[model samples]
Target: MDAILNLRENAARQGEKTLTRPTREEAEAAVRTLLLWAGENPDREGLLDTPKRVAKSYGELFSGYNESPEEVLGTTFEEVSGYNDPVLVKDIPFFSHCEHHMVPIIGKAHIAYLPDDRVVGLSKIGRLVDVFGRRLQTQESITAQIADAMDTILHPRGVAVMIEAEHLCMSMRGVKKQGSTTITTTFRGTYRDDANAQARFMTMIRLG
Candidate 1:
């Protein structure tokens, strides 16, 4: 719960401040250290290049840290033909690493918002999901981040976000419960105040 709150409070802090990062050489050295810790020879013929590969892969996997949600959602179209209904983008495929285990949490996201005066491009919602998913996250954090971004950036009437994911920390380790799934959701504005609106969002996600 504290982690989620910290994430929400810090959501707007990204792209607003300078972030310090390690260089590629430093990252590669860290991977080699991990290999040694795992009882593997870093100098072995086959493993000699493994550190470089892992470092490169980590750059792609965690690139979300370099992206800005405000910039991704900056543009909006007021010419939505006077449309004020809910705009939903469902089943947006995404995979994230669990902050606890740094293992995969594969899932789909369903995002819906009640537009006020304007609407954003549909593709922006998918991009928004990726912006958060490519980071070390808890399912709950991603769910809240999506809803918070839409709510803050678009100033929509309401926002609803649902994420269904399988955490590898639970499936591949800990309890080792394979195939188990977890769902997390965040509702804001009208979706939080009105039961009917929230129910309709659920129905659309289920039927679609």
Candidate 2:
């Protein structure tokens, strides 16, 4: 509970931090040290700018940490036209970091909700995934966070989230299987109790 609260607070603190651009010189120095330790010459022209480029790329790849899922889901539309069935957005691609290894996890997320009275914009679901996915996460927590966010924001009859990912830590080392994937899911409210509804959701997402 305390951890959840801290996440909420941290989300609120997004955009307050001073944007510090990492120095190319520092990155080059670090790379030099790495290359030296690995018995290579860092001064080689081919690898000279690799460190700076990598540092810049890191800034872009990890920028999601400075954003918030709650704020992304803040916009709500009560004008759902009373046509509430299941609003599902599937195959939402997300790139996240694994907290355990600090390596990348790339995945597709499926989100579905049965609205109560209010509904959110379609894009908000994607944004929510981005918010949660950008942080250091385990697949289990990522699944639960999406469900919880939808339950909180939409007060939906049910909310379901499914994630399928391939972790680099698993693929790049330690019994490496190149084609392996992991699936994690979370279901809330009616989706949790009603097998038929869950089945429908799974079928829908599984469809190509």
Best by TM-score: 1
Instruction: Write candidate 1's Cα lDDT for 60-177 as tens digits.
Output: 8977876779989999999988899999999999999999989999999999999999999999999999999999999989999999999999999999999999999999888999
Cα lDDT tens digits for candidate 2, 70-134 = 78888787886787788899999998989898889999999999988788899989988887887
CA lDDT, every prediction?
A: 0.90, 0.84
Which model scores highest in lDDT?
1
Error of 1 at 25 (Å): 1.2
> For every model shown, what is its TM-score relative to the native structure?
0.90, 0.80
Decoy 1 TM-score against native: 0.90
* Model 1, C-alpha of 66: deviation from truth (Å): 0.4
Looking at model 1, the pairs that clash are none
